[model samples]
Each structure stands twice: as structure tokens, then as C-alpha cells.
Target: MEFWIIVALTSVIVTLAVAWPLLRAPKKSTELTDDYDMRVYRDQLSEVDHDLARGVLSEEEAKQVRTEVSRRVLAADASASTSAAEIRIDSSRKTNLTALAVMAVFLLGGASGTYYLIGSAGTADQPLAQRLSALQTARDNRLSQKEVETRVGNITEMEDKATDDYKKLVAKLREAVKQRPDDLRGLNFLVQNEARLGRFAAAHQAKSRAITISGSKATGTDYTDLAELMIIAAGGYVSPEAEAALAQAFAKDPEDPRARYYSGLDLAQNGRADIAYKVWINLLDEGPEDAPWIAPIRGQIADVALMAGIRLAPPPPLAGPTADQIKNAANMSEKDRRKLINGMVRQLSERLASGGGTADEWARLIRAYGVLGETEKAKKIWGEAKLKFASNAKGLGLIKEAATSAGVAD
Candidate 1:
């Protein structure tokens, strides 16, 4: 577009230059051609005056014809000077100027529109680096979308086919990884599925290859995660070297919560409950309040508590009625129901405050209250359960009960 605009402007200049000379040349040429004629007419007029002055003819005849001859000579000169060439040149110049103006308008207008249209894609308000980044991002997104679609198709094919299906999937995924070694999706899928099929060694090999392929391939968190999964798939055994890998990853990035969580799992699995207990307790302190890992983390804590024989405060007995005593309560009068509830609540309250109930016992006690519809007593138990089981689901049966009791509608 820029090249064409320059060419057009150059052409316009050339046209104007060529046409200016042509338009002016005709008039100049006509004047030169008529010079001799004008000179002859002037001489003839002078000769007539001379003839009349020298008594060659009457003064009256000279005077009468002088004005007429002068008029005819001026008219003839005007006709000769303004020739067809001059009229044609003048008309051509006018046409050329009109064309040049039109061309200028179109060239500038088209260029301006094109400039803005191209510029509007990113906008000048953005830095050049940012524009380039955005362009790369958009291109990558398009390519990634296509890749995901292809992978979905591959997954469908794998689902439908049955002949060494897992191996075939791995082969295809390996080929894709080879085609785009930097692509994490193919490598990750390959490793996960290989592990799923109990091919831990192969998955480890693929992960190692991927780590080699992309120079900056192994992130601390991802590397530890993959290595740990490999170790688990390898029948829960790993060498000192494998341990060193996790230690190195943690050293490289100590702040990664997953690394911390898995480290605790490894400690627990290896029967270092003391170390595991310490690690998990610290993890609970450092991790997000609602981390899903907390469920397993708290379960481990409860297991530790059981190992140490640390018992929680016993929950109150069933208030109002027991689940099995529902018919008994129904058979009794309204007064009996109130008496039964008061006795149960008092006994349960004493036990809960005394602190000797196991986790399971608390769950059963709360469930008993719920079955009897002693909701007020159940709600109290539920609140206490939430605190006791803040991290573990076992103690949190009360939260569900609490929600139902509040009538907030699931």
C-alpha cells in the first residue's frame, strides 16, 4: 500500500509537469507564429497612412477604411493566436488536474483507512512489546485450541478401540510429544495414563525425556508431583536418589504447598509418624484454610491422635430421644417426651464437658439426636463438632446437620 501510494504521487507530479508545458506551449507557439502576420498587418496599415499622407488617395477614404481594417486585423490575429491546439491543451490540463486531485483523495483516504484498520488490531496505546506479546498469545491460543480438539478426538478413538489400547494411546501421545516436544499436555497425558496402566517405569522414562527436551522443563512443584506419583506407582518404594530428587525440588522451592503436603505423606507412609505429625501440623498452619488436602491432612491427624490415645471430650447423650427409642418416645405422652429430652441432654452435656469421647462416638451421638428431631440439642452438638472436626470430615457431620437445621435449602 505504501509503495503504491508513493508511485501514485510520483505519477501525479510527472503528469502535472508534462501537462503544464504542453498547456503553455501551444499559446506560446501560436504567438510566435502570428508575430510575422501581425508585423505585415502593421506595415500595411503604416503604408496606407503613408499613401494617404503623400496624396496617393483622398484623406476621407483613408479615414473611413482605417477603423474597419484595424478591426478586421485585430479579429484575425485573435482567431489565429487561439488555435485548436491551445483549446485541446487547455482541456487536457483541466482533465489531468481533476484526475490528479481525485487520485490524491483516494490515495490519502485509502492509506489513512488502511493505517487505522491495521493499527486498530492492537492499538498504539499499547507498547510495542505488549502488542507483540498479544499477537503471540492469540496465535498460541489458536494453535492450542486445535491441539486440544485433536487430543479430544484421540481420547475418543482410544475409548472406542480395544487392541492394546493403552499402548496405542501411549504410542500416539509419544509421537505427538516428539512432534511438539515443548508441548506439556501430550507428555503429561502420556505419563498419567502410563502410570494408570501400571507402567510406572515407562511413565518415569517419558517424564525424564520431557524434562530433557525442554531445557527449562522441570518446575519444582511439577517435578516433585510427577516423581511422587511415579514412586507410588512403582509399588510405594523409592531409593535414596529418588528421595534426593524430592529434597532438591523442595530446596529449590520450599514454599510450594503441594511439595510440603506430599513430603508429609511420604513421612507418614514410611512410618515416621513423629516427623509426619510435625510436618502435617505445620502444613495445616501454612496451607489455605479450605485446602482440599486438609481433609486427608486432618484424617491423618485423627489417626495420629488414635495412635497417641488422645481422646476428645465426649459428646452429650441423645437429647429428647435416641434413634432406636423414637417409637418409645412416640408411645409416651407429650410430658414423657419432655422428660426424656431433659434427662438425655443433661447426661450428654456432662460427658461432652468431661472429654473422653472418640471421633466415631461423637458422630454416632450427633446422628442419634438428628434422628429424634431434637434439633436444638443437635444444633449445639453440630457447632461443637465443626470446631473439633474443623479439618476432618469425620467430625464435621454436624456441619451438614447444621445446614439442614438452618433451613437454608441445599
Candidate 2:
């Protein structure tokens, strides 16, 4: 109320300031000049002199006429000279007043029109507390039930045939996981390798089993894995099961990059770019730095940001894994290989949570985890990888292969 009052008062003051100049009548038009009349009297005196010189009038008569004419000329000059200056000043004042009137009309009309069309002319300000609550509500509403139902992801079933050697390796790995069903690593690997081979149902099964084994110890990432596998198994749709899994993951950690990214992506897919933009912005602000999702978010945000009435700048390009880092694990001993592989996988998981990476890189990272039986991590990678490579036929194929090799073949 106070703020509005101030705005109203300022507008009034400006209007009056403009109107005052135009409303007041200028000083009365300057008295008419006598300069022309004075010139006429002088001409009469000259005529009298010429007549006398031509002997058309006697000297006495000529003298009287000349004196009268001279006196009239002097009177005319005195009066007109005094008034001329006043006329100019009066004209100038009227011109200035006219200008002010034109400006005032434009100013008042423009301000009023703009306020009527776009300004919050009569609304009260929302208090900070209320505003914050509204913001949270809006952000939470970004992922709607309708959206969850309508925007079943671009879940394509992988149908690529595996090579003979990889198929043999996969068969052996599956047997190993089956022999030791309690083996967390085996279950994890089974999920990825099965997924890569397009065994989506198997992948989902392995993921659920992995989660069950973790039981009370399961983390946000754990549920995220199962939810992702559910999405894949459902042909890119976020099924009720997948949505339930996502809810669990979000409940565990709202700021988890994977949850945030997928939630925003879901909103975007459902034609709620406005909500998605806000979700991504919040994710950018609160998620871990240099997370993988940042890259993809940066790539996808421009259109959504525009819809959301926000400006977006490109986030700094992420530096990808070094050639040696990607290859070093191959030559490492079992313990060293596990440590490097996990480190890279964790980094990739976090980075990708926001979204960015090539198909090959995504494939490699998913494969790394699939080999290690970290079904949960491979599931996260597979969920986002499908989105990232949706447009790239070759890349998508590579991802499918890696998903199968990792046992996440769905």
C-alpha cells in the first residue's frame, strides 16, 4: 500500500508539472508596434520637402507641414519600438507553452495506456513469505500427475543384436549373477548387461532385486536406479512404478541431480516448459558443481527459459574424461581397477544427473558400472542416456549395446 501510494504521488506530481506550463495563459500578446506608422509619417514629411523645393507650396506652408509630419514620425517610432520587444517575448512564451501541452498529453496518455495494459496498477504486493510459499508450490507443481501420465518418456526398445563374443560374455555374466543372486555387484552388472542387450524386463528385475538386497540401506541413487529401469522397461514411459520410484528418490533427497534433471525433463516433455525452466534453474543453483546434467540442461534450457520469461546464459562447457582416465582401468589390477572405475562412474553419475555427455562417453560410463555390477549407477546412466541420444541413431545403438553388456539391456 505504501509503495503504491508513493508511485501514485509521483505520477501526480509529474503530470501537474507538465500541465502547469500549458494551463497558465502566457503574458498578454505584446502591444502592437507603431514602427510602420512612424515610417509613414516620415514619408509624409519628405513629400512636403519635395513639394516646397518644386515651388508647388510657399515656404511657410511647407515649414508647418514638415514640422507636423516630423512630430508624428517621432511619436510613432517611440511607441512601436517600446512595444516590439514585448511582442517577441509574448510569442516565445506561447510557443513554449504549446510545446509543453503536446508533451504533457503524450506523457499522460502513454503512462496510462502502459499501466492499463501491462502494469500492476491496483494489485497489492505479495509479502516475501507468501511469495516464497508460492514459488515452492509452483516448483513442486512442475511435475504434475497429468504430465507423469501423459509424457511417458521417449522409451524405445533396444533391438540391436549382440556380437558373438559379447553375447558369450553376457551369457557367462548372467549365469554368474544367477549363481550369486545375493551378490550386489553381480545383480548390478546384470541390470546393465541385460539392458544393453534389450532385455528391459530382466534389467528391471535385476534393479528391483538390487534395491531389495540393499533394503534399509538403499540411498536416493538406489531408488533412482529402479525408477529408471522401470522407465526403460515401460518403453520410455514413466509408469506408475517408475513414478513411485522417482517419488521415493526425491523424498530421499530433493536436490539429487538425477531426480531434479528427470523431473524437469518430464515437465518439459509434458509441455510445461515454464515449470521445467524453474526446476532446472533451481537444480543449477543447488546441485553439485560440474555435474553431467549441467551440460544437457544448458543445451535444452534456451527455449524453456524464454517460455518461463527468464534469460539463460551458457554454462561453462564441461571438460570430459581424459583419454588416459577412460583407458587406464583396463590395465589396472583388480583393486586399482575398481577404485578408478568407481571414481569415474561416480563422477559421471553426478555430472550426468543434470545431463550432458556423448553417446560413446555415456556408453563407456554405463559399461564401466555394468561390468562392476553397480546396477544402480548403470540404471541412472541408462535413464538419462536415452534422452541425450534420442536423435542420434548410431549413438543410441551404442548406448543399447552398452546397456545390454551392463545387464540394463532394456
Using lDDT as the measure, which candidate wins? 2
TM-score per prediction, in order, is: 0.34, 0.47
lDDT of 1 at 405: 48
In the range 1-410, model 2's lDDT, one tens digit per residue, is: 67657766887799788677566654544466645676678778888889999999999999888888878777777667767767776787778777877786778677767877898856768997887687656655544333543445323444344577887888999899878989998998888888787666678778889989988888899888777666555544455466678888998887678877777765665556788898898877775666766766654566567766777665555566689876876788989977876776787666655456556667888898888888877876786677655434566788899999888867
* Runs off by more than 4 Å, candidate 1: 1-171, 178-185, 195-201, 235-242, 269-271, 305-410
Task: Give lDDT tens digits, candidate 1, residues 1-410.
Answer: 66557756875776567556444533335542456766777787888899998999698888876777798788777766677567777787777677767765776667657766775533337786886687556533332222322332222222333368656867787788779877766787787776655455566667766666655656786667655654544333333434555786786688767667667665554445567677777877776755655645654575664553555443344344557688788788988887786677566655554442445555555655665666656656655554344334544554555446443212
Highest TM-score against the true fold, candidate: 2
| Cα TM-score of candidate 2 | 0.47
Error of 2 at 76 (Å): 3.7
After superposition on all CA atoms, how large is the RMSD of candidate 1?
27.1
Model 2, global lDDT: 0.72
Question: What C-alpha lDDT do the candidate models reach, one value each?
Answer: 0.59, 0.72
The residue pairs found clashing in candidate 1 are 313-355, 314-352, 316-348, 317-348, 320-341
